[model samples]
Target: MISLEQKHHSLLQEAKRRTQPDIANLRLCFELLALTAAIDRDCAVRLAPHNLSEGKFVVLFLLHGQPHGLSPHELADRAGVTRPTITGLLDGLERDGFLARHSNLQDRRKVSIRLSEKGDATARTLFADHTQWIGTLFGGFSSEERIQFSALLQRVWRNTDAGKMASPAIAGET
Candidate 1:
């Protein structure tokens, strides 16, 4: 079986033969996607022992410190997910005793989610370790290199905004 790097090189060579485009930019995009997949896999492995999906972890991390808690809609918005998705995550988290839902004092119909004691403890422990894990991912970089990389990544991120996307005709050209 071919390695990923070998496959990537083969794909790039085929692309170069078929199109008159910036092969270097296309290679960078491919590399970025591979990096993202690797990072995601690493995250899943790290969270597995704690029985937390990234979505569940996001909800718990968001609700960690606030005694007042946030509404389901608020969590969906903060998590950048749809209402149904957040509801599913909330269901699992609540079922597992990671969170509790309380009705609002004035509006009994409205519900807010708060971290349970177990959830709080888990979040605290995960936060510390997670921070270190994330930092370690960048440990190979010097401070200045990290700063420059962050700036470059921010520039790339800005271009990824939906409103900034090129139209289909132009996008298809390259």
Candidate 2:
């Protein structure tokens, strides 16, 4: 039986030999990454005037969704980042008066991070403008196409996870 590494190498060679490297698959990956970067950069640019970074904006946005707040670990899990990274982002947000950390009443040892009024306002303003861009990006797809695309992407995610092809969290990000 051929080794997995050998099979992978063969597949790589086959991919390279293709005329356009499987247009649909290649374009899917390229477009997803490009779009993510573009969105991130645009958000960063908008946040810059307020002295906020992309990561910080993301943290604020996530927290804004759950006004009740989330623990650092929970926030990290939702944000697809390390706890330490979330910690730094939260630190910046807190320092800027965008959020506050409160000890969980049930578990004093656990800390919950909540957005301040300023953070709420910022999140609303940013997302309100961002939604226009999001709508434009997906406007070309019909409703049925959007549904089908989402289903197909979910199947791909499940297959990748079941096969242990990549981190499930990372797959979900795509």
Candidate 3:
């Protein structure tokens, strides 16, 4: 009775032998991971002047377009981080006057987060031409290539648990 780990190792070895796995698949995987890391680093650098980290900026971005304020748990879900992490981000934002937290009037037990006036202004300043920044990253790709790439990315995303983790509801929260 082979263990699961042993079976997986056997399969991987077989794949490497049969495919000579140092080819397109492996190279593409490495390139994609490197590109993602570079993008994240660039975003962090661009946001540093505003005293915001990438995670905090993501929370602000999500709240920017929504009329309904999000609870910390909801923000955590959308940001794909733990509730405690979101709490820390919210605390820092609140202290910096970028956002405010209020107890839900109808349910005093729940706390909702909303952007302060300062936060709104800061977001506007920081996000100017943000879409153009993203466009620059893919500028070399043709329109058809962009569509195909996007569809491929969507397929990969859907096949992973990462997509499920970003659902509107809090993870493991009733």
Output the number of the TM-score-best candidate. Answer: 1
Q: Could you tell me which residue pairs clash in candidate 3?
A: none
Which of the numbered candidates is closest to the native, going by highest lDDT? 1
On lDDT, the stronger of 1 and 3 is: 1
lDDT per residue for candidate 1 within 41-157, as digits (tens), equals 899899889889999999989998989899999999999999999999999999999999999889999998999999999999998888899989898899899878877775666
lDDT of 3 by residue, 1-174 (tens): 212344445555676789775555544555566668778888888888888998888888877855567988999999999989999999988998899888877989988788988888887776765667977988899989988887787665655687567564433222
The per-prediction CA RMSD against the true structure, in angstroms, equals 5.6, 8.1, 8.9
Per-residue lDDT of 85 in model 2: 95
Q: Encode model 2's per-residue lDDT on 1-174: one tens digit a residue.
A: 222344445555577677545655644555555566777777778779988887887887898878689999999998999989998999889999999999977989989899999999998888787778668877889989998888787776666546357666855653
What are the per-model numbers of colliding residue pairs? 0, 0, 0
Q: Which scores higher on lDDT, 2 or 3?
A: 2
Reference-based lDDT, residue 160, model 3: 61
Higher TM-score: candidate 2 or 3? 3
Which clashing pairs does model 1 show?
A: none
Worst 10 residues of 3 by lDDT: 1-10
